[model samples]
Target: MRFIFAFLAMGLLTIASCEDDGGDSVISLNEGAVPNILKVTGSNTFIDLIALESGEETTINFTVDKGQGNIASMDVVLFYKTGTTVYRTVLESNLTTFPKAYSLTQFDIIEAFTELNSAADFQVGDVLSVSADITLTNGSKLNILNNDATPNFGQDIANSAVYKVFQNYIVSCPSDLGGTYDFVSINIGEPGGFVVPGPETGTVTFTDNGGGVYAISDGSFGGWEALYGPPGASGVTLIDICNTLSFGGSDDYGDTYTISNVTTSGSNLSFSWSNTYGEYGSTTLTRTDGTDWPDLTN
Candidate 1:
């Protein structure tokens, strides 16, 4: 009976040893394996995989999983170093698809590596990273990267990247005119000929009310002269006059003019403008209390 019991105990010990060995085998196979080139799919705004090159060429095979739609296009950008700096270049592939299962694509490893090496300022052993930008027929863009297990890169793919190319044009006018001032001068010409000087000058004082509205006053006229409009009431808005006057008319050629390149000192205001009569003109208005006409210097 003791022999029988000893044999049963030995059998139990063998079973336990087998179970322990099996568990250890499974763990070692998983943890010890070297990571190969991998492609995982999640969302549109995914971070592109960054790969470091070890040789002259490193082939990359990618598989798009189920539930992911047909890839309309793929762009591969290579970033590498030369001498002391890094640079980037793009490689594109024609579109291909499968129905529902995974789609596989192979890339030319050496060409990409060589291109990056030539463009980037890097040494031979410098780190190399790989990434991809993908576009679908539905106008969706995706950036595939290695670290993007979580949902990152947001929803808008077009605006996700930092680098872009654009064209910019600037249109500006002279700044000296505080705001907008029309090119105005009294020619004093009669219907038939030039009028002779009588009381050749009068004093004009301009009071800027901020928003491009000004008040004109002479000691006597007080608020009699129009500030902006068709000389109706003494104080008017500049915009009103610009909308109503004709060029070379008594109404002071009402047209919206841009005032730029302003240079002001003390109580003097000087500005230039692209005149409405297809010419450039400048003016200098000085603060004065005199009553002489054309006394702009005062």
Candidate 2:
């Protein structure tokens, strides 16, 4: 991709050289000037707004190069999305340095939005995109992004593996479901005295494995442990992807399970699970942390 951009730049220089008639039709650019390419360096590309405190932030680092001395300064432009509308503001201006670094806190974004008269609060799933607005020494402006806020460069160059001029960060709400809860379960699929009777009450713990995945202490929530043989169910896990719950792993007998019919009321959550071995259980987990349970659904 770098080679392709270089080739295109060389072609542009050739056209510019031919147009320089040495009289009244001379371009202000140098004889061998090439287009600039914004190269990204080390950086964190996501803004976990949920985890950020009052002074926390995310950062972006990059450099402007390949301009062949024609580049003068650049401006950092920020674009944030809310609902169906995209609003933009000039983040920083007259940046004449190479390998520049900038950090943006949630307050910074909110302040920019306030400048645009936006009263909406930034939320999860919103995207914050950034780009460069370059100015040449000849007093000419060069911007690969069009007026419609879309990249005017070639698709290959925009998706280039060697260079990145634009960066987009998503506001993420990391899932953390690590806690202890009191649960009540009743066996339905395999009735009778083989399973725990009378809507058994017990304690279950959920261990967070990061990124929305969790290791559940009991897969059956005490429905299959006490009566369904010695080697009780284990290795059970659950995934809470964007408030949607799903089951993973199998029991001790290699019977995979499925979770469905998840419902929540205030801070309480309930769900039904069944394994392949004709064992089904309905359980309700009550939160003790006083915080409302996540609005999860299956």
Could you say which candidate leads in lDDT?
A: 2
lDDT of 1 at 46: 13
Clash statistics: count for each candidate? 26, 0
lDDT of 2: 0.64
Q: Report the error of model 2 at residue 11, Å.
A: 18
Q: How close is candidate 2 to the true structure, as a TM-score?
A: 0.43
* TM-scores, all models, native as reference: 0.22, 0.43
Query: Which regions of candidate 1 are displaced past 4 Å?
Result: 1-71, 81-84, 98-110, 113-125, 142-298
For 1-298, candidate 2 gives per-residue lDDT tens digits of 2234546876886675556455522222333232344424444445665455333555434444434446677777777875567888777888787656566656667776654332236565566777767777888666645444566553334334555566666555567678999988876446333555547778888897544557888888877655543334677788765687888666644567899999999778999998876678899999888888878898
The alpha-carbon RMSD values of the candidates against the true structure, listed in the order shown, are 32.3, 16.7
The whole-model lDDT of each prediction reads 0.31, 0.64
lDDT of 1 at 282: 42
lDDT of 1 by residue, 1-298 (tens): 2234546866875565446443322211112211111232331111112221222222223332212334465554444443445555554444344211222111343345555322122222333344445566666555443232111221122132322111110011111112222222222222223332222233444454321234433211211122211232222222111112111111122223344345555555544433332323344455443322221211
Model 2, position 14, has a per-residue lDDT of 67
